[model samples]
Target: MDRPAQISDSKLPPGNPWRAELRATASLAWPLILTNLTMSLIGATDVLMVGWLGAEELAASSLGFNLAMICAIFCMGLVTASAPMMASEIGRMAHSVRDLRRTFRQAMWAAFTVMIPFWIFLWNTEAVLLFMGQVPELAAKAAVYVRAYMWSILFFLFTLVARNFLSTLEKPIWSLIIGVAGVIGNAIFNYILIFGKLGFPALGLMGAGIGSVLTNMLMFGGMVLVLLFHPKFRRYQLFGRFWRPDWHRYAQLWRLGLPIAVTMGLEGGIFAGAVLLMGLIDTASVAAHAIALQIASLTFMVPMGLAQAATVRVGIGFGKRDPVWIQRAGWTSFVLGTGFMSVMALFIWMFPWQLAGLFMEGNTPQNMEVLQLAVSFLAIAALFQIFDGAQVVGAGMLRGLHDTKIPMIIAAFGYWVIGIGVGAGLAFWLDWRGLGIWIGLASGLGIVAVLMLSRWMMRERIGLLPAQSLSKR
Candidate 1:
């Protein structure tokens, strides 16, 4: 007779404790970290390359890109629902290899289905830019960039699905590799196309968009090729016969994904709305807000990577019915996130000018005024990073527990009802301008941090896990 497998308590170390957890977490986190950083670098490169074209081009492209990102952020959140589900399945070891393949295939179809409409909308984006109050010339330029970028959505979505699938399998390194390669490819393409190097036409701002599209396609192709031919993935029938669409599973994914989409959309919408609000103030204020936002974006990658790790760890613990491990994962991630942001905030506080100079050095008088405003805003922004980090990791823990909808609601209220409302009041009524706006943001994020952490704590105290799977019970 075959021997039965043994399962141990989640906290019962197999041999070593700290070393083991560190290894496990690092194994999952490093790739995610690299992926996040590379993704940031791609955005930074776009800004840098387009900045060369002219200030008007840079500003128009930035605004248009931010608008496009609001859409992409929502779509990304919907697709990210796949990560926790896949992680839980892997943790349970319940699915057959073929089943895993089918899951990924369905995810691709879902992503494609969602992206196509958005892509078509973006393809005809000139009207949208005009509607947003762009002048004809700037609107046309923005539309050209958006139109080029729209072509890459399908490919980018495919790569995202693949990356999420790997993350579920505790194989984030593959994502890191592909992300780095994509960044390199993007940089090379940007250099050639943006500057008319190597017989390429100098397309200016349009070239940055084209580079992004080309790199996305390459990344998608690379991921597909790797998954299809790699020996490890080959056993899973990754490229074998396509299964017919399973409506039940599809519905399940959509139900879980929709709230996530709304949550991300709300968050992105707040920032996009801020852009609109800033525009009403002055061009210098808009530029200042943009600089601070970009700086915050760079710092955000650290928490985001930790959050991804938290999702995987919590999913695994929940799958094993190990409440203690689940709690530990959440708290550990929170602590790590806090520590990382603390250090970053210190640096920003110490060298505000140095940091602002990255995007503002040697610019016009208007740009210099914007940089000064951004520097002043950094103090408030820095304080808020702690709360921002905490809330995101808390949300990730909730996602691991498959508790998404409530967090979505919390984010909606926190960002729209509280943050935006307060910021608008402060900016217009209080006449605090940028300072009032950031203060309002801090208040909203602080409330969200407390609420999310409280919810996680309550769930842990009750020894409750999500009801999505059998293992949670």
Candidate 2:
């Protein structure tokens, strides 16, 4: 909860900026890294819990959960618009309690406004899934999950807003604590509801969804309680006033947030689309794709966390009109992301079979095939890990600079045009199957990495537009 001092990089003694930047970056990044990883654990545990129910149930749960995530991701992106703006306000002027409060209020209204439609849409997606040509039985089961997860969307998006609020305020540890608590709560609830433990009726997938929904509410409540009670956040006076509609602030949030939403949708959708494409191959392919994707997603959380930190750091620097600190923060994040992914890639390369085996039965022929395909996919996943890390961290840096439009376009083109197109051609047109599809994903990520990095490299040409934007405050 410490108020971040402005322009500390300048006053520091010679040669100290490197260590200073590294320390600052790591301090902000590690808690977020753990938070994202722990958050991801909820999904992992759900998959593990549902695995006992059979492949159909597992696939249904995965499909339903992922579909919900597409909306959730977009909502989170919308909330993300507030974080950098908040951080910049802090760095630009030490006492920005009102600005912070206004952003938080607008964000709260925005969260509710957008998430309701997503929940409703999710509530009625069985027919949509069928229209997509998914298996009838599968679609029906997934719909049960869709209806269940819908209840969680509002709380989940609010939690994202709260997370951005706390983290950018230098109270990230609260969210980390709440996230861990949610995971623990989720596990206990899943055990009780998924298996009829502790006298609860066994509702199966329905139980899982209910458990998740309840956990989301609790997590959001945890954040609010912390903000209300915590000494450091008292100055903001966030909830004291009602958050009436403000079209100007709402427009500001939208213009910045919408492209981020689209960029993220394109990035996340390619992976989801890959899973569906795998579905076209067989149930085994779908299952294997899920397993491999789970592992990759887990590792990807590290860079994502770093990227978030970069956004905050870069935003602050931009607000302070110190492009030097901005560049330092940006490169520092990229290096950390790349270095961490290298280790993850090595680990995946060494243990693909072992990691893939954790998700399925080991003795059966069908499982063996799934394991092999999963291992193959993991290899491709490993190849792209660094690129994924670089691109995401790059995006985070640009976001910190408030450079959203071009990056969004770059991301969409790379993921959809290059990645999915290549994968689809190889999978369907060329008949290269799942492996080809994974390669396509890798190609897309690689292109995105190059484009984003190049953009950051040429940021001098992009100039001080981010800093200029802050003067309007």
Candidate 3:
């Protein structure tokens, strides 16, 4: 079977394999980068709008959003297993439409499976927060936001499946278009609902939640329509046999996806823990942390996009049993990912105040204090940007080879033991407060980056590669 022009390496310029890989990786990465940016913008817009309600409101909403994100990110990691699975199948046989469809279908099933329990957990957000030692008042307000926002999780998961499908097929432009539209739509809805514009009652924090749910529904609906009708994607019939089960593929998804989910949970959990920690410190600390974290997260989206691109590119190489291609793909993404983040680090370092200003307005004494703390946190984030980029991309590269279990362990130790442990000690034991938490975050990311890159370097000796690729080498 002839591979499609996009999947075949033969068309790469013969005399410059590195340059060819660079071009290929960049072409796939840019749209994904933009898509991730736009997606982050949706959240940032919420945070920005919510900031207007007051510091306590901002803190409460941030807590609610972060808590919801911890669950969503884990579930997303589970479904994302399909990306590498589909990419490798495409590499092995370009026209493996049935295999692709089954993988996608099972991934959606996996998403639905995980969403049920999370929804139950989110519905009782206030109880959980209080149990975790959050202030009763803030917890109650957060619950109000979460109850409305939680409904978006299912829609978001469905959209992720569709986005991963398009991304694996090397057609991520559709995701970018949809994401850009989502940002605009989300902003408009948030304004209308939160501020009570256009004859709608001002719902405040709850309004932000409702706006997100509506935006996610539209995005998911748009993605399904595209998959159903787009000439290229329609042939796969992703929704065909919607009720059928492929037990083997479903099991495989769980096997591969569970570790990925755990890895994401460990990482996202540490950040959520940080928010909880901030909540303990003070309302102002929680608000400042949210601003700084949002800025860091926005920049992190670029490397995340590169990481996603790396997963697909390397998965394709793995399918072809081509170690050299895999190396080229992985290394190309590493260089691009780290290089972009290095520049962003400098920008953050140089302009922390300006970046912090984007999320909050007015220079009242409380705002001024929060602004100062945010600036300090940005400095720490800048220092860790490269490591953050490296670790995420390295994880993506390994994931392409279907090596997730060890990374899960690595994340467990790095994020919780090293990241949170060090952070807690410094914050409380040493009286370093919020700044200490930021330092701990940087430390964990640095450690994880080194470990992930080291593992990638020894992939062959350690048997991370598929048996076929090892034998081929």
Candidate 4:
């Protein structure tokens, strides 16, 4: 079986394998990086727009957003399992075009099945918030936001499926383009609805949620249209006639996706737990934590993007039976991701106060306190980005190798046992405050990164993986 040209020839030029590897990595990574940064900006825009409504509003919105994200992030992780599997299949060309189309239909159906019940549960968001012990007013507002956002779930799931399909097809730029457009639409809609601009009624927080929903729908619609009409996708039978669900492929997808969901859910749960514990301190402290979390999330996008690229590259490489190329793709992506994040970290460190001010206003005593604490946290957060990047990319590489269960366990141990355990003990028991919690997070991510990367390196050395052979399909 012949391997795809992209992976087999991805090696460095005669004298500079490292440089070639870096170039290859950058080729796949840059677009994703840009897309991530843009996505971050969208989040920043949301925060900024909503912050004008006042601190409680901002806090409530952030809390609601995080709650929704907890579920969405886990779902995204589950959907990502498709990327590696699809990439491997595409690289090897193992399945007929018909089979590929049927696989995608089944994947979409599977996603729909999972999301329907999830959305139903979300419809009673206030009750859930109450169970989670949120303030009454905050819970009410959150419920409204959740209900508005719930309408977008089907579209969001579709977008995820489409993005994964495009990514596996090695057309990530399309995903980026659609994301950018969605952000633009979100901003526009938010401006009009949140502030009642352009003759619209001011819906406040609900406006933001509605705007997001509309943007998602628009993006998904556009992607689907492009996929159907675009010559490239058409030539590839990207949306050929749909077929009945194949239980075998459906089960395979579920098996691969479930661990990913658990792994990411645990990670989200740990962070959410940190937020809960932070609330034990004071509203101001929780606000500061939220701000810092947002900042850290921005920095995380770089590595997240790199990890997505690594998943595609490595999955394709593995399918082609080229161990060396797989190793090259993984390492090159790791180095590039690390370096990219390191630069972002330096910027955050140098301009912590300025950056913090972006989320805090008026320089009042409480606001300034949150801002100062956020700056301090951002400093620690800068260092965490390196490990964060490494761990995510390592996981991506492993996903390419179709080795998800072990990585899922590693994430569980690192985040739950080590990260949350240490953070909770320090923050509550020892009274070390917010810093204590962050220290635990950093430690957990660092350990996970080293272990995962080491595992991938060892696997490559043993030749247990090979480049995907396109002819197999």
- lDDT digits (tens) for residues 198-253 of candidate 1: 99898887788889999999998889887888765666766566657867767777
Q: What lDDT tens digits, residue by residue, belong to model 4 across residues 1-473?
A: 12233443545578777677677667767778777777677778788888777666776776677777777767777776778877778667743355556667767877777787778777887897778777778778878877887777678778878877766655668778888998899899999999999889999999988988898899889888878888667655555555565788888888998888877877777777777667566666667788888888888888888888888888877776766667778888888778877888788778888888887784578677777778878888888878888888888888888888888999999998999989988888899889888888888888888888888878845544643432333
Q: All candidates' TM-scores?
A: 0.91, 0.96, 0.98, 0.92
What lDDT score goes with residue 269 in model 1? 79
lDDT of 3 by residue, 1-473 (tens): 12442554665878899998898888888999999999899989999999988889999998998999899999989998998999899888887889999999999999999999999999999999999899999999999999999999889889988988888878889999999999999999999999999999999999999999999999998999899999888889899999999999999999999999999988888899999999888898899999999999999999999999999999998888889889999999999999999999999999999999988864799998999999999999999999999999999999999999999999999999999999999999999899999999999999999999999999888987777776676
- What range of 10 consecutive residues in model 2 has the weakest lDDT sum? 4-13
List, residue by residue over 297-382, the lDDT tens digit for candidate 2.
99999999999999998988877777777888899999999999999999999999889878887677877887888899999999
Report backbone clashes per prediction: 0, 0, 0, 21
Candidate 3 residue spans exceeding 4 A from truth: 1-10
How does candidate 1 score on lDDT? 0.77
Top model number, lDDT: 3
Better of 2 and 3 by TM-score: 3
RMSD of 4: 3.3
Off by over 4 Å in 1: 1-19, 94-96, 134-137, 460-473
